[model samples]
Target: MNSKKILGSILLSLAACIWGGMFVVVKIIVEEIHPIQLVFLRYLVAIVFLILFSIIKKEKWHWNTKDFRLIVWIGIIGNAVSIVAQETGTWLSSAQTGSVITSATPTFMVIFAWLILKEKLTRVKIISVVMATIGVMMIVGIHLTGKHVLEGVLSLVGAAFTWALMSVLVKKVKTYSSLQITIMSTCVAIICLLPFSLNNTTALLKINFFEPKIIFCLLYLGAISTALAFVMWNQGLTMVEASSSGLFFLLQPVIGTLLGWLLLNEDISIGFILGTLLILGSVWVSVKFAD
Candidate 1:
């Protein structure tokens, strides 16, 4: 209802849209690059861009030593662990399975915020979460069957929980600006990922970085999706309650579905239309009434 809350919602929605569009580009590039290599390259570029931005702005990087633990937890669980789980789950299962499972992130976020941050869980918020979650299931066309059903399902569930925890944890951080938080968390994540990524150095080296399309995809992933999106998300989280922030994440799937229909010529079924309306309605309910 307040200006800051409204702005936060809009910024988070924009970040979700960028991530939604990224699904299409990632699908294309993943075929040519290993997941680890791609993720490594993305964070590497993002960190560089963030450092330069920080330098240009002359932002102070100092923080209490006690806060370092929170930063590390965020980087490890939010970035490193969640990413590995999601990628491994997708490899073991189908992308549909990954999408459907990850859609539960908002619900987990609600629960985590309630338990960890002591955020209020009103009736309207509960109903909105249920509505948005059902909409996501319908939109993603939930399919549990995959090659390694148990492993994939567990991994995806882990990813969803970790991602939710990360979002909630962002609200707990009060010592750093959004840019500083983004930079520190990303640095920690990159360090945690280095061991795994090092093994794929040969694969990374094999790719032709000079190629225009490859360069474009990498920049999009690094600059827009990683660096910019993280900053926007942290800023939004700072402005709104974590539960309210969770509602905005549903936009990712809705946007991703629409993009698929438009770009990939994917079918737009009646279920998809109905689901989209339900999700939109949930967003309205959460934003207008939940608070």
Candidate 2:
């Protein structure tokens, strides 16, 4: 109802939309690049823009040695591990599968927020999360997948859980600005990813990364998705409660699914529309009544 919460909600929604579109881009680009190397390159681009933005905004680079481990762990979980898993899973599975499976992120976030952040799950919040969960399941349907999909499914599930934990941990942080956190954590992540990316980077040198389409996708991933969306998501966390914040993530599925259908020729059913309505309802409830 208040302006700050409204702003936070908008930022969070925008971040979700950006990330949803990221799947499409990743689906395209990951065909040409390995997932780990892609993540590494994405962060390489992100850190450059982040630092420049920080400099322009005159954001304090204030940091304490004690919190270095926290930042590093958060970086590893969210930036390095989750993103690598997500891209790999998407590569192995259909784009829709990637989006739909990871839509479970909000449910994981709710649980983590309760356990780690000790944010109370109000009746309203619980109902909203439940409704969104049901909606996601409905969209996915009964026949989940066979053993063939096990690897991708596990990777995506791990991504969701780790990402959720990182979100809650980020909410616990109050001293650093989002810009500061994003820059520092991203730097740490780039270092974390370096060793893994060597072989892939060697492979990368053989490909024409400068292809027009690939370049455009890389720019979008690095600048818009990673740099802009991350700052928005993190700053939004500062404005709202961690529990309510997760509800906004439900939007990612709708956005990702629709984009996947339009761009990737992915299928959609009546369930998608019906499920999306439930998700929207849940988001509205979260914004209006969540504790």
Candidate 3:
């Protein structure tokens, strides 16, 4: 209710909106660029921004051995693997399908937290898992009537599982500022993309860097979505409970679904709305009693 919490909430909401909007952006960008290149560029721009901020803020550059290990693991899983999975998944599935399946991340996170971090799973968590599963099924089952739907469904499930792993990994690392973490993770992603980036030299060279859409995506992804949003998220979590933070994440699918419909002319079926409600209920129950 205070200004800090209010600002955090707004920033978190904005982050969710950006994430939601990203699927549509990816769909558009892939028309002109390979997914790996696009994902690489997204992080490249973001890494530059984070580096600039670290310099401006005089954040310490020195990192301990333990911190280095944590960043390396986080970078590999969270940045490299998660992006690849999500991009590949979206390519295999519709944005709506990908978004809906992604809503199950909290469910995966709960299980991971319990096993890895010794967090107790209460009755609330159990109910949440069920609701979230049903919601996911409603969306996937309704939309997945095509022959290739199984492939899409598998891709989405893979993406969800990878992202869930990243979320748990984030909670485990205690060292490094969020900015440092972002920078390190992005650098790792850039390294991971080197082979693909090198192979696509002709295409990369032909790309008009000044293109309006590319510029827009770069700015939004780097400054607004990646750097500032990440900082705001870490700050918000400091002021709020973990369960409350997880609740806000439920906004991702809702905002993404609506934004895709409006901006990209992506279809929104009855099942999409119903599925969103189911996921929302799951998130609510998870957050309410996971304390």
TM-score of each: 0.92, 0.95, 0.84
Candidates arranged by lDDT, highest first: 2, 1, 3
- Stretches off by above 4 angstroms in model 1 are 90-97, 144-153, 265-267
Model 2, which residues run further than 4 Å from truth? 140-148
Candidate 1, residue 155: the lDDT equals 88
Winner of 1 and 3 under lDDT? 1
Candidate 1 local distance difference test against the native? 0.81
Angstrom error of the Cα, residue 76, model 2: value is: 0.6
lDDT by residue for model 1 (178-256), tens: 8998899999989988888888677778899998989998999899988999899989999878887887877777776
| CA-lDDT, candidates in order | 0.81, 0.84, 0.68
- Tens-digit lDDT track of model 3 for 1-291: 566656655665566667777777776666677777777887878877888889999998676787678667767776777777776667666677767777666677677767776767777776766776676556544455556667767766776676666656656557667677777777877898888878979999888889998888767766766677666655555444343444455566676677778887877666766877887777555544555
The TM-score measured for candidate 3 stands at 0.84
RMSD per prediction, one decimal? 2.0, 1.6, 3.1
Q: List the residue pairs that clash in candidate 2.
A: none
Instruction: Compare the candidates by TM-score and give the number of the best one.
Output: 2
Cα displacement (angstroms), candidate 3, residue 132, comes to 4.1
Candidate 3 colliding pairs: none
Candidate 3's C-alpha runs over 4 A off are 1-13, 132-142, 145-151, 233-247, 271-284
CA lDDT of 38 in candidate 2? 89
